[model samples]
Target: MCCYVGCVSETAIESIRRSTRVMLLFTELTAVLPIFFLLQERRPWAVLGLLMAGVVAIIVIRVRGTLLRLRGLWEPYSYARVYGLVAAAMGIAVLAAVTGSQTGVFTAILVGITASEFFVARPLGVASRHVGIVVALQSAAFWIVVVSTGHGDMVGPTLIGTIIMTSGLAYSVGLTYRWWEGVLKLEQARRDAAELATTRERLRLAEDLHDILGHALEVVSLKSELAVRLTDPEKSKAEMIEVQRLARNALRDVRALAHGNRRTDFGTELTGARGLLDSAGIACDFDADPTALTTSERDLFGRVLREAMTNALRHADPRSCTVSLAVTPDQATLRIVNDGVAPLQRDGEGSGLAGLARRVEASGGSFTARAVEPASFEVIASLPR
Candidate 1:
């Protein structure tokens, strides 16, 4: 198993299946070697026929059980059928003991013990332990029968050594199967987690699109309707111009959202915020300097500015809004202040603001949003230089 770990390019599950199949083939050949040697000794045709039949049956059953288990299709009936074949092989070994053929008895015992390897294919820990105990018991029974029935010529430490070797091989193979199962399960869990994270990101993007485009479209609709009701051509023209601007902004935002490129430049956002505030009939005061900030700092502060502007437009009845940016030797700061603070209608912050705060903190910064005065709402974000 260790030798094959780096020999394949398949996935974990496929690798496990390939390795288990190789192990089964190796064990099958070794189990049949003893019978092949006994035939070289000119054993009786009847004895060879019976021993060959039992060996073939045991191999077929083990192969079938191993395939089913690897495909995760093993059931109670399959398990029972394999164990029954093992019993028949053990019966053959008892017959060999009665017939005074030491080689046949040893081969039968080896095949029966190898059959227990199929039981270890089950995924259950308790079942593997039980199968191991049963194999040990069967080996002990074989040794006792071989010694008691005057077949003691080969019943010294050599007999005990063979039993130990077979039992150890079976146990090691079972443990390796269990270890592979655990690795495959862990790989499956990681894949599931990755898929879940992708799903959540998709949902988040949907929500962001709704929040951005929905607000812009609603404002466009309201302003266009107002322009329609106006009797003066000049006022109607002005309102239509504002509506056009809003439409273009919405389209740009949609493109950015679709491409997963939402990062904003601080200077661009400040200019856009001033335009939006003026178009909405609110006085705008903008103050920012980008010469001292790094690209990451600008991007972070830009997102904060955008979110604050969005919240102010949607949730406040402000007469004026102010955006100010300042950079010192150690840090850079952004503050958005608006008059006419609305009453708090929710107990918690919105996801947009929460996400902004996380971004700010992730870049070694700080964010705060609160009503700084009875009529003024303020948002402050600070980042290290």
Candidate 2:
């Protein structure tokens, strides 16, 4: 079977993941920069708390990477640690704000923004709502303290900047996953189309010795049986003579099939139909005695059977089907009766029948497809004998 080969390369997907991870972590560590501006304004312990928040951030990143590698897709293990550091940063912001320092307000906003990003790469699912509420409360408290200390001018710009930064980090990875899923679906559809083309080619080249000899051999068996049961010796000898003629004809057809002359064979089509139905858990019954047909007629009717079988597999969930051949001295008829036809769909359902009907009519034959009952459909083709 053929398969599609072109797809988004593994190198391209890995590159996207690495670039987004680096950018997100870089933003998270930028919180400690405000401590530089506050070197002389705050006590040493207050400065140490801001420095410890940065260290906790680096440790949180290492843990996230470890969890992603070990479990591939698991909940974050650093929940308690991430928020604990956010709360500690907010506490320090309150103390620094009492001195009416403007730099201390910026430090609180940066630390809150940094702590929120650790959960952005892979969100906490439903727990993320709680994350937003906790951050919103911390941000409101920081603004309130700055306003009370007569440092209200820094409120608007600082608040707006942090919100924009937080929103960008949150949506980046989710957008990446959406891109990944859409590419995979298109790749799978390409592979299915390729395999279908290959299967049609194989079916066209499937002529073999067994299929070439099938009809003639059945005729020989019937003649031999009749000869064995006859009481008149002369009649028995005549039947054996006819049996020898069929055996010779079978040998001639086998040689022709080997030379790539015959395009279709009834025995080959019959075998393929049986295998398809059996694999799908459908019970199929083929008639034991088939009407004798000319070589060209056999080829034509074999194609009809193949087309009918293909439609059945694709459109219906059938439980049982019967394939039979009938003769009326003037015409030879092939009929397929199948159960489990879907009742409501008329558009494009059994749509190939229209083209197949044209094929049958061009060869001085008639074709029809009709519903026999609520859950049954029948197809019939007749050619002049």
Candidate 3:
């Protein structure tokens, strides 16, 4: 029996069925060969009949190939049923051969094969118990009938012992099958969880792209309109330059969004922040050490850095902004502070710091963004391993 159950692919099931058919045919031929040779002298006609039946059963078992070429009509259980029927017929024929003399041997074979079929064709859960009960009853009745047969060739105690053994074997096979079914269900659940994670990540990337590009485009549009109304050529040129810068920033962010690869270079983000703060007339200082960080940590740090830079350039209006990164044995830390940042503005509705705090908390980290002094605002994230 194949240990793999739940997620058995079609190709694998077909292969098992083919091998089973060949094995069943060989077993059936071997079992009947003794009967054919033993009864040749006493009952030539019966010998010929049993041989013909065995040949037919072998043919039926091998007919799976022709059935496979058809449509939905052909299935594993379909062939399994054919094999079971052949086995039952063989048992009945064996009983007919020695009915007046001994019926215990043939009865055992008949009941065992029929009960085994339920486990082979049906799923493990409900059918396991059903087959167990049926086999138990059949085994009990078989023993009782054998006692009534009064055949001296088969000892009375031996028949009872055989029935007991048959019952134990049948119940064991059913329980083993149930365990195999559970493994299949577990495999399916793991596959589902992986697919769900992939879908959620894609949605997150899509939302990030929308936010970044939408803001950059809005700023560019506003600058373009403002440049048109300006009387001074120098101011108009400055506005146009800012508009061009926004466009390029938007393009870079869009490319990152398209790739959907959540890897970040801290050094690159530091350089980009310097250019943005310098253009906005805010002195920005960044400090960090170069080291390899895990992909998840890098992405988290990048998002925090980007949000801090955006807030300083867009809302804080501070003369100077400082960003720092510290790494320790147990944790990685990021701190951003800007002087003359109003307390009310730090906690304002327009600030996206609250959402960033939530993200950090969900990732088993801590985030704090608030006004420490009358005019100074600070945002800090501490991520622990």
What are the lDDT figures for the candidates, one per model? 0.68, 0.60, 0.57
Off by over 4 Å in 1: 1-54, 72-101, 105-132, 179-183, 186-190, 218-232, 256-262, 283-288, 322-344, 354-385
Q: What is the C-alpha lDDT profile of model 3 across 333-362, one tens digit per residue?
A: 988888767666645533356656766898
Off by over 4 Å in 2: 1-42, 46-71, 74-102, 108-135, 157-385
Model 1 TM-score (2 dp): 0.70
What are the runs in model 3 whose C-alpha is more than 4 Å off? 1-104, 113-136, 152-194, 207-215, 218-232, 256-263, 274-299, 308-324, 337-379
For each of the candidates, the C-alpha root-mean-square deviation to the true structure, in angstroms, is 5.5, 12.5, 8.0
Q: How accurate is candidate 3 locally (lDDT)?
A: 0.57
Each candidate's TM vs. the true structure?
Answer: 0.70, 0.42, 0.55
Better of 1 and 2 by TM-score: 1
Residue 76, candidate 1: alpha-carbon lDDT: 36
Residue 37 lDDT in candidate 1: 46
Evaluation by TM-score, superior candidate among 2 and 3: 3
lDDT-sorted candidate list, best first: 1, 2, 3
Report the number of the highest-TM-score candidate: 1
Candidate 2 vs 3: which has more lDDT:
2
Q: For model 1, how does the per-residue alpha-carbon lDDT over 1-385 read when each residue is reduced to its tens digit? A: 4334334334755666677657655655555665664565455689768867876777676566556755655343465664676567666665555554445545544534555556454655655665665566666766777677766776665356545554565565555556545555554555566677688688667656755665576567657877898899998999999889888988888898889987657887777677667666889888788766788988777777777777776677889988888899898999999987756543235777887777778779898987866667889999987
lDDT string, candidate 2, 61-169, tens digits: 5446533632334234465765665566566556555553655554554444435535533445643564566558656876777677676887777566544443443
